[model samples]
Target: MNDVIRAPLAFRNQHEILNMHHLIIGAGPAAVTAAEHLRKLDPNCRITMLAAEGVPPYSRMALPYFLVGDIEPEGCYLRKREGHFEAQGIDVIYGRASSLDTVAKTVTLLGGDMLNYDKLLIATGSTATRPPIDGIDLDKVYNCWSLADAHRIIESTNEGSRVVLMGAGFIGCIILEALANRKVDLTVIEMEERMVSRMTNAPMGDMIKAWCEGKGIRVMTSTQVTSLADDAGVLKVSTAAGDTLDADVVICATGVRANTHWLDGSGINMDAGIVVDDCMATSAPDVYAAGDVAQGRDLSTGDYEVQAIQPTAVEHGKLAARNMINGNATPRGGTINMNVLDTVGLISTSFGLWMGVEGGETAEFSRPDRFEYLNLQFKDDVLVGASSLGMTQHVGVLRGLIQTGAPLGKWKDILLVQPNRINEAYLASAQSQHAALAAA
Candidate 1:
């Protein structure tokens, strides 16, 4: 183990000791993981986590199941044991961090309190994007991002209640599955041509669309919700295609935006998110950003991008913590941004830059009837991105290769020529990698 020790500053001759206090903003998975990693590096250092939400850091990804009551509230919690942070001597502050003074190394809370820090990490995640539609403020309209939103949706659902979801993205699709399981009359309206258009290609989208429709969930594609109205006790949604649907509740899963408004004028490089270098360090010294708010460089494209997934966020936090404690010995490189969704008996996985035409040639394989599809896009004979549906085993192999940027010349032939024959090889490679990492 590295000999990193977190300690407080010592005072001498009337000069206050400059204790190394790590102040982490946000209590999401990234912040929590960073805190734990920092503790491992420096057990005695002071660590404080400031969160806008009053609840402790929980699994936001599991909100869909919680909405349908498939999982209890406690199941969404990240910690397995009680008083996890307290046991570690880490302080958790329940309040919003309104502004950050990068130069002064201070953070201002919503209640007028300020805290100083030797190093600051901004991991404030993201919030769902609500579109500018008429009557959006009406009751029964909800956005699915927080635990409170899930509870509200769960409370609103009852037998025979009609629920309409806007946007057919991952959140929307997963929520549809959860609600359909409860026999809720569900309707999905998407502005895009197919479901999960951003994450998947057309074949995978069609597979999900067919599956959802087979489950009696009405899916509207290439449609836009122009306005929403309240008709007596029910809600009426008007679409751009001159179609109207009635519902008892509305859920919006349009998209997400990074929580970086507070740092607009704080001298931090801002694009779609706060820009950070490989070390997760901002342009200013002693200041770093991670998680969804940090626009770290994408290894595949060499461009700053925000990947709002829990695993990536946790990895970012761990890397940032390591850099901070180890005096920046190791370079903080980006990883493959991948996402997996298990919805209604279909497993879908995607990684890297899927849409861009620049990287390389693309290869595809599909079995529409069985809802199986695989698309590999390569650049300079190197695998860059892939989308797979109904092929869970193959996704694992592709994800490994993409992450390692391994030479796929030999593997590609086996994968493309005799895919089934190479299953054992894929499993062996994956297990070996896992074992090596565990040993290290």
Candidate 2:
């Protein structure tokens, strides 16, 4: 933007990536992040955003706080201040991208119009999926993935209302906390043996479930929601165990799937998600993907994983924009599986593969009576994955060890004998890495 001239491609290898138009599909945090970064880099570049919903770009993560009345609906917006997009010269369209034509470099909207772009980014994010259970389509049944869902739940329920929640995953647990704060007679039903299966191991997850139940919330684990029925305006939820629970409202937070069905015939390398390289570019030229819609490599495992969390989305969003400016000039470091959760008053954290890998060693300590637990996974002498509850100081140390891949050496033996010495182990191991680097 500072005296840098951009122009169209006049030769096969010659290019002007900055002087171009960017059409981004989706208006979530990722889209907004990329748009702002692009504007800063190329002030005169044309940018347009498209989203299926009609609201301003907002973060789904903040919706839980909105339910507890801590913040108003407008507070959940990513760019809450008025005229944000207009001031940035970002043109927003409220429509779905129905298809893509890579050869023509145009995107087809649901309304039968095609939009052209010099570079296209798919940040459409993800959609919450509901299980194939009967009565899921009932009026009181809802999900917590969108802002509209939040409005419906808030409008329909009152304090002390009977509520049945399905799925105790990360998103579900957040909503669970909000519902508890609302004083709802809340009951949770999770198909997994415990809670937060994807983030923590069985023992840690079981402890979380116990902590939730101890808070006077009824938690049903290893259970299935068979069906639901509305009788005289009352919703009755039937479980697989032949038990029936009645509810004033049903909230489903089972899981989410990438919202990329519209790209089925788009000639993009499609799999469970859109295949993308470390640069965040798709198989096609000038077409990149990020957020949940992009299946990029996982740094720890080197496998393609969809991290639907907001931080990963924001990082990849910015990374993809930089690559768009220079044609994959700055490759991505890849994403890791990381999550920190606050269920009620309890704090939990997980990083990388919290569950120990094959032939990997593990160190664990637990005090079920006090709801404190920690598990560390090690491959050879290096810490690879970890999960913890009730320990805030361990958060940075755990991530640092896993990310730096520093050898634990003597510290590994110390952890296996007494995992509570996390701080000491981290200090010793980090110092060892520093000394080794200096010696070399």
lDDT for each residue of candidate 1 in 1-440, tens digit (9 for 90 to 100): 11112223222112324447888998888899999998888876778887677777788888877877778988898786877887786677777777888888898877677878888999999889889989888999999889999888888888779988899887887777778877888889999999988788777899889988887889999998899999998999999999988999998888889999878678888888888888898887788888989888776778789978777798889988988787666565575688888776688888886654573677677888888777777665456788878886555666665665555555566555544433554454445555543432
TM-score of each: 0.91, 0.91
Q: Give the TM-score of candidate 1.
A: 0.91
Give model 2's TM-score versus the native structure: 0.91
Root-mean-square deviation of Cα positions for candidate 1 versus the true structure, in angstroms:
5.2
CA lDDT of each candidate? 0.79, 0.85
Regions of candidate 2 where Cα sits further than 4 Å from its true position: 1-18, 431-440
Model 1: clashing residue pairs?
A: 6-42, 9-19
Residue-wise C-alpha lDDT for candidate 2, range 1-440, written one tens digit per residue: 01211222222132235458898998888899998988788777878888678777888989999988899989988987677787777777677788899989999877687788999999999999999989999999999988899989989888889999999999889888789988999999999988988887877888899899998899998998999999999999999878899899999988899988988887889777888899999988999998988888887899887878777788788988888888788886677778888888788998887888999999999988888999999999989999998887647778777877898888899899998897888898775565543332
**Predicted structure 1: clash tally:** 2
Q: Least accurate stretch of 10 residues (summed lDDT) in model 1?
A: 1-10
Among these predicted structures, which one has the highest lDDT? 2
